[model samples]
Target: MRTTPTAHPNTELLVYGIREIVDVANKIKGLDPALELTWENIGDPVAKGWSVPQFLKEILTEEIHRADNRSFAYTHSRGNIETRKWAVTYAKQFCPSSTLDYEDILFTNGLGSGIAMLYQMVAPGKRILQPSPTYPTHASFESFCSGNAPIFYKLDPEKGWAPDIADIEAQLQNHPDIVGITVINPNNPTGTIYSQETLEAITRLAEKYNVMIISDEIYFRMVFPGHTHVHMAELAHARVPLIVLRGLSKDIPWPGGRCGWLEFHNTDLDPAFKDYCEAVKKRVLLEVCASTLPQMVIPTVYNHPQFNAWNQQYSTELQTVADSIADTLNQIPELTVNKTLGAFYLMPRFKQGSLNNRQTLPITNPQVKAYIEQAVATPNLADDKRFTYYILANTGIVCVPASDFFSPYPGFRLTTLSRNPEERKKTYERFAEATKAYLGSG
Candidate 1:
């Protein structure tokens, strides 16, 4: 007799929405080789034509050619001590009140790996209150660990995508199992840089509820003009246990480098928290260490005279693209467009009742249209996802549905990372035109 293959229960909880859409688009591309897919589904700056700064590249190259180079060997399990020390010193400029030391930093392959490890170490039966419309990795891993759909608090789009504090409090009150709260400042999918007041309010709740705060500050340095990035460590002030996640991927435009670290704050305040940190470190010991090349060049790249200028220019360009895209999308009366103040994404939501199952864009290829029709026919398909599929088939503009962010709203998230002004304008115009046609159809 033959036996069926078995899989772990946790496997079912893992759903990466961005990749899911990308897989569909990949199949469609195979079906139509001529389709020019304009990728807006993911937040890869380099994929959209941005280049890494020359100074940083030079620093890495020099490190690789050095006589004493240890780039090929593993460092300490917690990452290079000198690099961690540099991180501690540099981080202080933003969070003067933080009590983090070199020992508090633990480097991981990337923030994606770091996120998975953090949630995996959570005690069984415990949960984390994640934001709706969250970065999929956070929600997926949190759910995988707990064996349940993630508990969520809303980020109200009507209020500039700010966290609903009262809703957060209510969820904490209602769900005693929620052990931590995750915040993505200059948030993904909806580029909203949280205000200081907002961060403080969240810190207060964490203090009151006695839950640790997981702050994803990967885009900390990417704030556009007229906004400042507020470090969560400053708000916690050694009163609340905090885990601050940072990375070199976005700001450095080095996604391939895959370097990120976790900063633990106020672990001394709780014995259990201290033990938890130790457990995480031990887990890191199993993996040995993160990439050595990126670790060795941290101090040089950050302190380089040209670094600030490069980052400023990058942020300014993103702001221009953001404003232009927002303007174009807003012209469609059926959509609600919020001009992003930080980061490089624009999430345009359809006005309530504007999207219906019956609406779709015209796809010229009959085979592609048939495939999409079959794709959307799945039971309980989200309105935003259906529209996203239609957009992919019709205009070859691939975007992630906002619903994949575990959002309750109907919309889609697209990046403003493309450096070409003319191409960006043309893409958004075509998208806007498709939006109008889709909404008007039903």
Candidate 2:
């Protein structure tokens, strides 16, 4: 008798069960057939009414007209030599003390690809420390690579989502397998920027523990007036090896560019760390190299005078939306909105015990209500179940639950990228109303 074909399986890697913000956005996109879909769920600034500067467009157009770039060609897995040189120069401006070379820069499809490749190079079961309620890519990549959950050092919500250094040290003490620590400056989901004091303290921890430091500085240039960007390399913990990730995705507002690079700092300090980085480089060679067109545009975009003006204007307009959002949400006694320092997302926490299974948003449709009922019955009855669906069914607005962002509290996250100011205010007002109605506060 012929045996049935069996499905083959092997060990799971470090990435598992971690949901992405894009997945959430995609789900919403599928749901709304006719709605305007004020998209705050993802971090694509271009979609938020910010257009590329004219100089950048001209540069990109000129590159597109070049016949030499039309063919598929390969560069060193480390990246193009010229782009690498510029990266070194750009990084040197921030990290003046450290001498960085072109060899220090490794480019990839984007920061996401860079992160995945970097984590994959580490030995199996070796952990990379990450912040909780983090940019899910970091947590998901590490978890996917290790075939186990990535160890998370909590970013305290009460402390404005700042990294808890003491907690990190304690985790490192217990989990000796942790080989590195990662921080997202101008952090995703929560827009808090780390103070120089916090950055220095983290550097000290890395030095003490002899662990590698991986700083994702994708939002380095997105800081508003009160908040300033700080590069991890600038901290210059010489004893601690550093791998700094930066990209054009956020700063240049070019998500489609699919370009970013990692700069090695203190590579000379550890032979083992150097070897791991080499493995990542070899993998990049396997994939050829990052998109050359986007790499070519970097020098022009960063050099253009209009770049700073566009950034400043964008930040100012976003701050206004953030403030409006904060003021609107504050009217509701059941929920609390934190100060948004950077990034495009706002995380609002619902008062503890304020949300229970018994309370729910008023849904007119029986099918939607039944769907939500089944969704909440599972072991996970977090804020997403109530708030996310409530916003969907009642107000026809959708948002991700804060718990989806790995938060322990009962809360939800919303975006301030609505181009229409009046509609934006109305959305938040409706959010406040829906939240109150759900909690029976009215």
Q: Tell me, by lDDT, which candidate is best.
A: 1
Candidate 2 local Cα displacement, residue 77, angstroms: 3.1
lDDT of 1: 0.90
What would the per-residue lDDT of candidate 1 be over residues 6-104, giving only the tens digit for each residue?
A: 897789789888888889989999999899999987888888889888898789889999997688788888899999999999889988766789998
Which 10 residues in a row give candidate 1 its minimum summed lDDT?
Answer: 90-99
Question: Which lDDT tens digits does candidate 2 get at residues 1-442?
Answer: 9999774332343322223434533454455444344445666668777776777788888877878874146666677788889888888788888777888788889988999889878987789998888777788677777777668888887888889989999999999999899988888878889988988888898888888999988878878787788878878646689998889886667898898899888888889888987788777777767777777778778978888888888887778888888888888887777878886778888887777767777656565567556756767566555567656666666667776666666677776677678888788788788878888832
Please report how far candidate 2 places residue 73 from its true position, in Å.
Answer: 4.5
Q: Extract clashing residue pairs from model 1.
A: none
Off by over 4 Å in 2: 1-36, 70-74
Q: What's the CA RMSD for each of the models? A: 1.3, 2.9
RMSD of 2: 2.9
Return the lDDT, model 2, position 344: 72
